[model samples]
Target: MSPRSPREISVLVPPDLAPLYPDDPSRIGPYLVLGRLGQGATGTVYAAVDTASDSPGDRLVVVKVLTSPELDSADAYPALEQRLRALSNTDPTRVVVPLTFDSDANPPWVSMPYLAGERLSHYVTRRGGLGTGKLIALATGLAEGLSALHTRGVAHGSLRPSEVLLESHGPHIMECAVAASAERMRGAGATWLSPERFRGGTATPAADVFAWGAVVAFAGTGRVPFGPGEPEEIAERAAEGSFDLDGLPKGLLPVVGRALDPDPERRPSLREVIGAVIAVWQAENAGEDGATGSPGRDELAHVLEREWQAVEPPARVPQVIRLEGRMSNHRPGRALFLAGSVVVALTLVGGGVWGLARAFGPEEDGALAAADTAGERSSSESPSPEDDPLTMVVRFDPAEQESPATGPWLYTPVEPEGELVRGQGVPTHAEWAERWEAAGEPGLAVIDPEAEVLCAKFCAAPQHLFIDEEGRGTWELTGGDFVDYLSWGPVVIVEVTFAEEAREGDDTPREIVRVTELFTD
Candidate 1:
């Protein structure tokens, strides 16, 4: 099946979308637009300044301004806004945090806590699998985040890797859809299956699981879950339960197989898949006897390391190359997937998935794997350190703490309070610090609500090379390509930690791989 043209999937208006806002940019109620972050199919996100308190400018927020005024006021989308608001109130951690909901504006907008990080696409392309430990951390945290949404009777509907944000805080899911019922829903909310959704079908948790599998596929191989084609074609193949899994790691075969099941009912739940993946992760890291026999874990780890280094940062001198790409080229409501390939190409290079397409694309599916490598090589370059901040490293510390009521806590230096013991890495302490420092002193910070206590749940920390006060450019690594579900931006990282007493109980440590570096110049 041929890929659909851009005009087939969605339409894009001119960049001058801000004029629709009738109110002053600084005082939308109590929220202020510090800078324009990015726009999505449904809304525009701006880095907003919360002027509700004394330290008005100090409080940062992501204000999601709806692009269409009619959609906001119409009764057709009744439960849409209400559903998101409910999600925020019931499960604060389920989706991103929504601070305020206001329909007073021409196009209603919501103010949410600003996420500091890059898009997951950017991070994954720049950095390959973050080792077994990091992968476990990310997957587990995201699972909990998913669980939070599910518990609230909300299905992410869209659970693609690009939609998942890997923030300094942790991995987070975004783009909740109650409004999608108006059109159609199908096959787990993955964009590649949009056409199939229009046929009165609804996206279920199982579909979400399948898309999660695709996310894992991209994370592991840096390729699409299925062969590259239009949304209809991909859906057709997915419905047939046919996928190219030759490039997937043998350890992940079982999980991928179950996730891609043609029958949604046959697919595992997100919780179950998370358990299975976590088990695989544990086994993979079990050392000598415990490591899976499929491939040399050390060799794979090294390959991933090289891939991470290949994502050259943009040039030190910032020069905006205006690409005359058309968002409107893809048809609105149609499956324009050539763009998916392009998205894959761009994100893989950006995430540092070196030779990923080459490793997994063609030899596995008879597609042009070389094409992806060539594309990545041609366009990949280190982002400019000047004008924009270069995100060096992102670390999630479940142990980090912050004062309460201060709102979103900021990044602080990691103390490394003997967090690691023997049998973890480098086999000793001396090597651990060396490795940590070499990795660029990555630490964790939180945005918890504690009156006087130090709560560590909502922490965001990034290794910043150059901090930009202008706030014009977003260092976006993950979640940059998708819309914000809970808050103004997508949830890049979602984390849940348990105390020692509860560790033996149902509560255990959870880590969501956060897409880091959204805020830069």
Candidate 2:
């Protein structure tokens, strides 16, 4: 937090391209240059407008140009481009909304959601230390966002304060700005980065947490966590250093310290870190006017209970239908696992008496099991509850009918209202469920808790990706199972589920339910 002047550096485009950009602004595709926002060692960013989408009502976007062809030509560019493009469309809760990527575009550009807010660095610079409430909100939101990216097999290589943007809702990390790559690490200032990263190691959740600790320190006292100096010096110190948080606020010190741990493996998981920070905030700030900390655990729990009770849960609805029993000799087994692409085929095959048409009901006790038993002609009923029928009825239209249906739906009723929660490297069923709850309560299709829980609405779109919630890669689903996937900065993967009921409120919702189960390999 050095009291340096807020410098707005302008980038002068090459002369030959002057006609494309009337005012010396770089031109790429259908975007109009406004002014230079900032610049890094390998790239320059501009606050530009999408001429294609700028017809009165269209929104603005910030375009980042990787000026150094050397890095772009290296192996890093392709992977970075693919990752960024994936994040933008798939992740709804992503702070950094990638609009498009054109490596062939004159400057090799990447367009993202033009966030109109102060950088986390600038925000702290202008307004000293953030209050506890705001800090808690910011940290919680960020941790969740990072968790989402990690779940998608991506790690934000860079997590500095400046890389984070503070928006009206919360913090939005800018993944492209850093333009992290293996070449960038090996070529130029690799020595200035963290020790674990410099040793040919990629980014991880633990490292992000460590950077987050530095961000907390910066927010508390305008200074880099590893002690401010030249960029290289700071990076070098961080690679082999630790932070001393003894003087910081009692509740926040632990978060700052744990995140700043030198060893990536030793640091707290994002879930653990968030839990600690949230607990501290709740304990100290609950009900106290202008207080940064929350109330005690019991009090906060009571408050949460009261709040939950106040908002009546949405009535259950039928979205998708499934069968539980094994399909006999005639067609597919009684319990059929249809490939996402084979919906119509399965419907055609399961018609007539063999088809068990079970209606969807709410999340009541025996409703699911009862629905599974609608059409079978078995007497002894050999299997118990665990081994009983497995048909799940998901009701998409809960509002259409009030009285409980005789059968159950395939999807579960998830509460999807709140800020988005990021997944860890791989998310568990619970983490996926939590993210669903945060994303305006979107519906979820737990395909195989033993395999991949078909999580919908991790961001704005419905994404379907397999995570080794069980830790063994044996259950991973490759490529096609998901409808769409979006990356938010470098911290989250927005799993796109195409079912009609997977709609979300305005902003992209992050669904961070199970972090321990995230798989990267």
Candidate 3:
């Protein structure tokens, strides 16, 4: 539903602002109206609780009464409710799935889990633009939601900041099935309407893409992409290509720009949009090990915490422990001596050679071994490659490579603890050489100085890799040249073959040749 005009008093607020109104219904089928959540052109949503449930502190739900003349018909309610139920059963990752619906009531209404959060418009208004990671998370969720609907031949005709609810987990698309048909030509901001919709075309999936871009622009800039004006004025401005995307993150600009393309046919599909967003997110959060995965619920929580702190500074907890009685006033002059003694004791007990081996061995090797063991145990229980939910594949173009021509490039993770690494446009030849020399040039891989260097802005795309039991690596890129690489960020992957030095416990005497592949996906 469209957001209420800025001049009107907002009924959406914390519990304090959601008091019951005289005209509001006390009961909606099995649900008891707790208070008014918000009112829109189509209907008024109320905070509700299931009256039949005996449990105390029952989870709240929201019931939207279909008061609009166009949507209140008996025949329309059944079809709409059925569509919503089907959409809800399709997936729960992208949208706020509907709980139930009542078509037999005096006024048909639909129930959905009550998300304790504000609309995207209010969030941007209160907190300004979201950080890159949080924005990516939101974009990913919304795109997935749209993808789910589009796959089922349903379109979210109205997709705007007002239709998005920002919650602790991630942003959730609201009023999916019902709103698509009910509010196809009304109850949406002008800036979010696609050119096709304005020209009397039906709301297609592409139109939803256009609206998605506009909403994203609004989130990033706290202003509509087509500038501010009346609905008609804004539509005209959009037709004239007057929208500005200056404030969007560099990594997201390309995707958003393409989505906002004046020609609806030029806009990328919802799945493609999601891939671009993921690519940017992976680059930003990639760890030193070069393994990449989608951000988990924990990351979303972190974003929520930051937003919360921005609106209301967290109260500082008082320090309960005092150092006065726990330690002597005078600093210990023999601190160095004590530390030295401990080191000497360790060396003596472990042996000088063994101690040196511990210090010199690759620190990550042990962790990798542990991870391998755990992965082996879980692999059997995990879905097969075909069924794997996380597997993502995109075409790789060798001609788009961006690194310099040099000998011996090293591959490393973006963050020490990160699983995804950029493998496409990172560590130019010069950078690789510096790292190689510093690491004592242990690998057999040679970089050829005379090799041609291919560089392009769209060289690096986010990828996911799978390592087989034999330690062979395979990977898939997530975006392409048509996708904006600048907004997606840069990454590189390199493979090195080297002789691993034998340690004291090894049965083999010395060097054993091994192939090591480094990737950012």
Query: How does each model score on TM-score?
Result: 0.49, 0.47, 0.52
| lDDT of each residue in 82-104, candidate 2, tens digit only | 66665664453635756777654
Judged by whole-model lDDT over C-alpha atoms, candidate 1 comes out at: 0.41
Q: What are the lDDT scores of the predictions, listed in order?
A: 0.41, 0.43, 0.49
Q: How does model 1 score by TM-score?
A: 0.49
Give the C-alpha miss distance for residue 218 in model 2, angstroms.
1.3
Clashes of each: 67, 84, 28
Question: CA lDDT of 239 in candidate 3?
Answer: 72
Over 287-330, each residue of candidate 3 has an lDDT whose tens digit, in order, gives 72343566565564454335333332112111111111222212
> Which residues of candidate 2, in runs, are more than 4 Å off?
1-27, 51-57, 68-70, 90-94, 177-193, 198-200, 229-241, 287-521
Ranking by TM-score: 3, 1, 2
RMSD of each: 23.5, 27.2, 26.8
Residue 214 Cα positional deviation in candidate 3, in Å, after optimal superposition: 0.8
Instruction: State how far residue 484 of model 2 sits from its true place (Å).
Output: 41
Instruction: Tell me the tens digit of each residue's lDDT in model 1 across 264-299.
Output: 777778778766866676576666644554445455
Instruction: Show model 1 residue runs off by greater than 4 Å.
Output: 1-24, 54-58, 68-73, 90-94, 103-105, 127-130, 177-198, 287-521
